[model samples]
Target: MIPSWQRSSQGVPRAEDEIASLKTQLSSISDLQSTRIGEAVAAARDEMAHGLAGRVSMVAELLTEIGGKPENSMLNLAEIQANLEFIGLLRGPEPPDLPTEIEALCERRRLIYDARDVFGDLFDRVREVLEIPEVSVTVVGTVVHDDEVDDETDEEL
Candidate 1:
């Protein structure tokens, strides 16, 4: 009888079945990680969009007040009022604590990425022990600039 590690006359080891099983498990893990990361990313983006919408509305209101007396009398206050009208259409019915929500989402996304990376490294090590080819891992997501958002808003005004 051939050793379990040795190939049979057909040129495949009994371990092939176990290896296939591991592959399936690894694939499932990867799919789950991808899904989770995708969700975190989407949540972060949605939070930012909501936050920015609210901010734009606030900025428009501030501008409406300030635009009344431009240092340059030649500057058209009517244009500012028109812009305010445009922005009014985008305001949320109920204001959210957008800065806090955005910060929380960014933190959540960061933690998820760190966890996924650690798991992926361990998964690859297991595949190596099994003598299976290493699966390539790719992390796809945007880097949340929690600080830059505020800075940009300040600069825009």
Candidate 2:
């Protein structure tokens, strides 16, 4: 038999303490992993931004124009670019919104990360720290558990 301190009331290993510690570690690691996923998506967006570099230059030139009234010259170029982008949807550099090719590229990048494989890696990391040795929890004599209740039995002995 294991030591008394290692035994719980139900004669099982004292898992509550281990569970609490594991919960803390898991929450922190999960948050960090979540941030990594967000970073990956941001990287994908940045890669897609390269497709809009030319449009960015056009907008810059339009904004910097000083020869004519703001609306007339600026909007003329803007409207022209809009029409060009719409017509050249499947031909030239991409606009900001419709990321057809970019979306495929992002999916390709993400495809390498299979769900089963990613989760397997995560679980492997977690298990590396899971110390499930011969746990022995000593049983307490009292059965009092912390539950929200009112024992208003006035007829009690």
Candidate 3:
């Protein structure tokens, strides 16, 4: 027959072990969520960049055709107008293929924000469960503006 304090002491170790396991699982899930968010943002930016590049190429071609055929000024004007319309379509309020990959990225970012908030709460809960004091995490970094500074110095000179 164990004393009451002994029984309580035995339960404390089991509780601590469970808390540690939960903390590990939460950390892993948070890391995975962060990685997915980063991937989604990268994919969206790439898609937008590619679309912009294609639009620029079309505009350049229109300009070249107009420059090459000065006599057909009316035709050139019509071509330019059509090209402009296309550009406007690309940037219009109602996109042809509405709710695109970039839109998905926006949704993913919101989910990431929510997940981060939950992660923070779980971190706090873990600390409480393990009887650990709260701690603040800090990150420090430096930004080097060598190119900008050099350009400014050259302009001054």
Q: Pick the candidate with the highest lDDT.
A: 3
- Local distance difference test scores for all models: 0.62, 0.58, 0.63
RMSD of each: 25.3, 32.7, 26.1
Q: Estimate candidate 2's alpha-carbon lDDT, on a 0 to 1 scale.
A: 0.58
Off by over 4 Å in 1: 1-14, 70-157
Q: Candidate 3: what lDDT?
A: 0.63
Better of 1 and 3 by TM-score: 3
Rank ordering of all candidates by TM-score, starting from the highest: 3, 1, 2
Candidates in descending lDDT order? 3, 1, 2
Best by TM-score: 3
**Candidate 2 residue pairs that clash:** 6-136, 6-137, 7-136, 7-137, 7-138, 8-137
Task: Find the 10 residues in a row with the least total lDDT in model 2.
Answer: 127-136
User: What lDDT is reached at residue 21 by model 1?
Assistant: 87
Model 1, poorest ten-residue lDDT window?
A: 69-78
Candidate 2, residues 15-109, lDDT tens digits: the string is 77678889999999999999999999999988878656755565455444422343344445655755675567756575545676457545644
CA displacement after TM-score superposition, residue 135 of candidate 2 (Å): 73
